[model samples]
Target: MNYIKHLNSVFELFTRDSRLNPTHISLYMALFQFWNINRFPEVFYINREEVMVMAKIGSKATYHRCLHRLHDWKYIRYLPSHNPYKGSQIQMLKFGTSSGSNTGPSSEQVEEQALVPYININKQNKNFNKHKLPKNENEVLDFFKKEKWPANEAKKFFNHYTSIGWKVGGKITILDWHSTAKNWMLKGEEIQKEKTLYGPSQKRDNLKIIKEKDYGQPL
Candidate 1:
């Protein structure tokens, strides 16, 4: 298989897929790495724990769910094993045509053709901001409300991020504003829990400390 072509094709497919989350992408990449290590075998056996560690997945439920979803999406063929000594089997579905084929264009030609659309897309998006952001405070408020978050928290999130140029730690640019907002809410919850467990007079500087951490990076 042409590794570069395969990754480009799958990533292009991923862009069009709304059902996939970061966990799904992480798991898929981990599986792809294992497939690579095994010399791209037609089928391979994998230990659940080993895959989970490679994927940085802590929960088995999440790992299994994403794995099954990938299978259901026809990205891979999964064969679960009942025996404790044997690992589960996986067959990665190829997205690109075989490089050894004689009928198609040469490898260089194929690569160039595959990159043409991306070149056009980059040119078209030259003037557009790549990050996802709300048009206004109202949009942010609406999203928070939809997620059952406090209206005031929406304002806080919008104002805070806006002041920082929608970046985490005033350095890294945020790609998904919605996910950032969700993380903001989660941090707020943690702060609230801390206050409840200790006292209302807890130092507010802790919030500033938390905000200093880079939230733009994926978990």
Candidate 2:
């Protein structure tokens, strides 16, 4: 049984009732941790000072007020003790109970239903930034057109990722395709530098070939 979800169900009701403040919620959660540790027993003891510390309640007045508020609201049943050595016993409502509804389940049903549903950390994050990223090569090329990237370099970037199924470093998915395009532009600068370095040498060789052909012709 998912006790956290059970607590969440109780909290849903609390959301409807605006009277429960953050302080009340904090104190309730502190009690909840104790209830969980003590294995959902019929009655759990509370150490007022310790609970105050756990809930970050600054004063005894606020602590007792919220504690009694929870009790009075039927969120928990409080049994007070006069003895300083003995702590008060609390039975938290582990399942459905309206503030004043007669439809509160029977004790047996309440015991069975007290244990409830699960909370999920759904894997929606994979698709979270997908929309913001380029969907295809055309979009990628168009995106780089306004930037400093050459068209061919943009195409190379697009094809590189497209061939590899749009993943980065073989495993991690690229969340931003534009960043990859920028990286392609940076790498292209290195290629352009190499071409520029050898460009004059190629021109010189071409000129020598033309001169040799002219010298052999009719001079």
Candidate 3:
């Protein structure tokens, strides 16, 4: 299978309706990438340390918290296991569905899991509005940074680029954006808007203009 095509398909699965938060979608996408390498459809293992490393997260504690959240949200199922070769047996993951109806330990059980609906990546890509910006790497980085984007939001920024048809050597670029990076900045702006309109959640406060930097000269 074409690797880029597969990756695009996986990404499409997550961003379909925006039902899943970006972080969750990213985590699932990572898992899908991992699955492509292992080819272990029935059983796959991921440990806390490994997850942190893959996610580029700083703290193991934070990784554990995220893991728990994923589990609680039914994004993946964790089966206890003990392996002499490995640290922990967090066996198997079921992606694309929350309902226990479609996947589980057995193939038959998996067949019962509900299949989540996702948009066609090809369709979205065709429909996405291409927002051209500066081609200078520094200018691009600075523009987003000036927007008060978190250091970890590189992925979403990269996604924006792909959505706009930017490519390098005919390959899609991967960004370093962490899960909450873009959402945090967007949420902050939303909060500011809400405060301006509703006179704050707690008290009436002066509103500050958050100037967004313009895209530098296009290439």
User: Lowest-scoring 10 consecutive residues by lDDT in candidate 2?
Assistant: 110-119
Going through the candidates in order, what is the number of backbone clashes in each? 0, 0, 13
Residue 183 lDDT in candidate 3: 30
What digit string (tens of lDDT, one per residue) describes model 1 on residues 104-179? 1122211111111112334323323455678999999999999899899999999999999986546545555664
What lDDT does candidate 2 reach at residue 102? 25
- Stretches of candidate 2 above 4 Å error? 96-219
Q: lDDT (0-100) at residue 128 of candidate 2?
A: 36
Off by over 4 Å in 3: 1-21, 80-86, 90-219
lDDT of all predictions: 0.67, 0.59, 0.42
> What TM-score quantifies how close candidate 3 is to the native fold?
0.33
- Stretch of 10 with least lDDT, candidate 1: 109-118
Q: What is the lDDT of residue 174 in candidate 3?
A: 22
Q: Please give, for residues 1-219, the per-residue lDDT of candidate 2 as tens digits.
A: 246446556767656665666787888888776566444555656656545555666566677778787887777787888976345777777653233332212223121111111212242332333433566778877877878566786787778778887754444455545544544554456557867886634435533444223211111
Residue 158, candidate 1: C-alpha displacement in angstroms: 58
* Tens-place lDDT digits, model 3, residues 1-219: 233433444454444433345445555555544444333233444443334434444444445554555555445655544654333323334333434242322222121222233434453343223323345445546655876665345445556555655432123222222212233344456567877898746643547544753222111
